[model samples]
Target: MIIFPFGKAPAVILVAALLAGGWLLLHPRGKEDANLVLWSFAKTHITAYNQALPALNHAYPDVKLSVKQIHFEALNRRLLSSFWSDLPSQPDLVEIEISCVGTYFKGPKEQIGFEDLKPRLVESGMYNRIVRNRLATWSNRGGIYGIPNDVHPVMLAYRRDIADSLGICVDSLYTWDRFIEAGRRFTVEGERYMIELNEQNVGSLECFLFQRGGGYFDSLGNVIFDNPVAVATMEWFVPLVTGKGRIGADLGSGQNAAVLFYKALEEGYYLFFICPDWRSSFIQEYSPRLAGKMALMPMPAFYPGGRRTSTQGGTMMAITKACKDKDKAWKTALFLYTNPEGRSRSFKKTNIIPPFRDAWTEPVFHEPNAFWSGQKLGEMYIGLADSIPPQYSNPFVVLAKGKLSQALVSCTQYYSVNGSSGFRDHIRKALTASADEVRKYQKRGLIE
Candidate 1:
């Protein structure tokens, strides 16, 4: 989760960018007119942009786009360095991942790196149709800097065949307590587990804390890791990995963890997954034979009827302030993110949930997902989209996530050595230490 913006360059990336750039230069299409350039870290996103190229070209006729794909960390460095160096090698529009968006939206509107997009959104009347949190994440000081490309609402994916054979009604387990009860029953024998407790990736902890209206920092820029809600969340979560309710197997990070998880998934060693819409690609690529056996459902509420969803990942389209032609840049960004036809096409191919509310009504959104037992997953995910709470956007998210992951790993080890009597205090102590660590970065003006 710590996105290092500076790193050693990869040789393959340089070669690929050189080849792609050479092709763009050799092609003479739209060379005499307005050229709108974009930069991204994903080839799939560039492919999606190509799908909308014809429509965008027909609408504006004079506008042409050239999208460049590079390393993710390199893109962050390019964006930040462009702001200081007056955008010498930057794009008119750039793709900002959710983790790095906060860094670009800092300070006053006039002093920021990106253009304020609030007026354009309000002018087109599209502001009301997009999810509020999606806009809020890329906004600072009441100025919007980006358009949300997708809404990553998280859900619980379970193996329907396993649950049914175990005589467990997934729908009936709407609360965390009920889900724990079912997990206990599912793991009565020691051959399988209910879920994998990923200590290396603390995303599940973030999801729970966000659902309970708690986060690393509050809206007022104060660290709130010591809040009662956060305490209770850790209290509830730690027990699932230790003692009697040890139904969650610990999964580490890197290729070994991925290989183990895939093996467990394929062999039916784990029965549930907590992730967002993007996880479908992982299933299809790794466990294709298990198609139709998985089913999507709302995450179990922390309390009865409480919020059941949170977000995981996102990509926002931002217009750099260095762009000379702001109007053309906005047109291209808006078309790619908000146009019904273009967004529908991307969703059909990538399974990315469109952030524009109107796009939910498109015919493609209603189509059944064959991988999930023909379920209308688009509708199910969109239903809980509005309920997602806002995260504390700050440049320190990388630091915070790293600290929390370490804390979770430490706490898990302590519980294994000791017992569950004072485990809650251990987690609270670790969180307090993390809050203090973040405070040092805040004092240094590394975050605000």
Candidate 2:
């Protein structure tokens, strides 16, 4: 009886000890089930997320992920409000504009470190895949805060028939002077005007200033608007919009200008209009009849062979520190940005330009668009993308630009109403005041 009891006792004790050790190893301390919530403001980006999620889930099945959609404007406000509340439940992932990213970076300390995801991104080739310089600027800082998902650069959309009639080769119309001259020649009385310029349509002005080696702010964050180049650009723009040298109309708003532009195109009003890549899609949707008559080209340079581009609108994707599942979230963000099929789907479905450089040459962009005489719409967009420079306007810079524009408008109105003796003096004083305001933002470290 003694021998039998010893054998059974030893065996039972060994089995129990092994089981306890296994349990301890398998269960991590303070570890919870993986789940993530992604808040996206981009309506079209949802398609990209849907296509990318299955693959991500395949790699990480244990993680449950969900998306909450919000409008872009609403999302921006929500981010601002969240800063004040210091809430821990903010979105684990967000889509924000590059111009406003500085705000988030300057905000709460809860933002996840970019170093946390750098290894995976570099391994996945997403880090080195960006082709456009302009897009690169968005995430080129020491630690990448966001990934460029798409880009929309300003371009010149022209009526091929009218351009051909005027003996102007669209490709040759590369400089601002030539572009204006071409507009003047194409403008006919009781017919289409040459171009449309307005307060809201300031892309051309911004692009011109950029090309002439003049920027809104200097490297030291000083407002520098009274330069000779700026003066020249403004002088040129004032006449063009006021109907002095070209067949132009006073466009009070961008939407109003867009309507008149389309109407003019339908009636053969003007030969060219400044448009974005999204505009082509809009034209196809709203005025299908104008298809085959329209074509897009890069923005004209201020001088021959100068850089000719400006960013219009696009969205950026960033990971939040609040995410419980950092690895899974990084994988999802990489898949959406780098997958060829995923990028193509975004372009095909939403017309969003892929941030990946190689994708620009994909068949999706090169495919002849039926709306533009079967021309390769991708070529036009790619050209504009290539033409984009490193110059970017921060949120503060954008606000200052609006203020400066208003000052210019006010001066013009004063001249029109009061018959001011010295237009140059009035412009100088108004610009000086605007510059001082811009300098304040620079002092606050809002602009670069």
Candidate 3:
């Protein structure tokens, strides 16, 4: 069904030449960027940006932005490699998730791939407009690398239908002691649990540790995972999830973790989760049937009149040093992040509270919804957002969390064999070992 206009040999030669030319184009060693590019790993963020792109276009028709989504790990790898190589393929702007940003800080301060935004932020007077605690996570060695995307303040999301049916007042459960005591009454053998907790889930445990003025590192970047508050928290937390009467249940893992956890919640296997604001939207999407039955409250403190909130995950926007157009990149990011219209639209799409204080007064943050049993979720989140503590971002944060998880596992195993009779001393020794192990890796060079 084919006919060659010329002889078969000439036609074949023409096609081969075209193929070689295409290969050269694709295999080029280096080339100047053709347009302003933003590389983001999260599709939700991309979708939100797309929704607000028209506004961006209207504001600056001359500034063109091409948003692309790359796989999380692959993007992080490419970012570091391109940074080190100073490759032309590097994007002008990039979105760095919390877990990935720390690796960028592994090198010396001057060698960091991202631009230090402190001067720009301060000069524009926008630094004070943003939440201080959220800013801390994107900072390293006094350099603020990126702008925070959300506050990610932690709260207690519970199954209110279950609470109401059992005649329990969620508001009265204001402290961990009361939460644990209340949990024991309804946490039946297998029918229901008081909360989503596991000794091995490092991030959630880190949330608890963070709430009490304790975490993996101090302001000086030293390992403090074995600090007094952390040890005391472990002593109190371990007994709740172990033994035959455990009130905590594993939330499962992998890409479908939220779906799996929500399914279990619908089945009444669990009653609570340590919810960040972004997670509230996921709950709405994955567990739609639970609408009107769910409610959120500030996290219970260790004791009465104590810190009532914590922070978990975060993301940041940065302009890579490889960029040739820092001015245009900054304009684009500021519009996408701080503009009132974009902030409102982005929050509706993702339920991620904007970290900028000016945007907090938006109408969306004050709206009440039946989804959360009429709780003004955004207002509550913002009220606690300013109080959310600082977590020092570091290369060893991930390693420290992993080591702490291992320590928790060791404590659980020891408790299984010996019970809680001597867990206080045992946990202390285990955490000390964990801190020592992380220190070993901290001394080793990560990139070399």
Which candidate's lDDT is highest?
Answer: 3
For candidate 3, write residues 1-448 as lDDT tens digits: 6778898999899999999999999998676433689999999889888887888989988777889999999999898898888788898899999876788998678899999999999999889999998888899888899988999998989889988999889889899888988889889866788998976777667888899989888877788989888899887777777876678878567798767787898888888889999889988888889999999999998889998999988899999888888988998999988888778877777778988998899999989967899989899999999889898888887788788989998988888778888888998999999999988887886433
Q: Which residues of candidate 1, in runs, are more than 4 Å off?
A: 1-34, 105-109, 188-190, 446-448
Every model's Cα RMSD, please?
Answer: 7.5, 14.0, 4.6
Worst 10 residues of 1 by lDDT: 2-11
**Best to worst by TM-score, what's the order?**
3, 1, 2
Give the TM-scores of the predictions, in the order they appear: 0.89, 0.79, 0.91
Candidate 2 global lDDT = 0.65
Model 2 misplaced regions, further than 4 Å = 1-34, 59-63, 105-125, 135-143, 189-191, 200-204, 211-215, 218-229, 254-261, 393-395, 414-426, 441-448
| Model 3: residue 387 alpha-carbon error in angstroms | 1.3
Give candidate 3 regions above 4 Å deviation.
1-34, 254-257, 446-448
lDDT of 1: 0.80
lDDT of 2 at 237: 65
Per-structure clash totals for the candidates: 0, 2, 0
Q: What's the distance in Å from true for residue 28, model 3?
A: 17
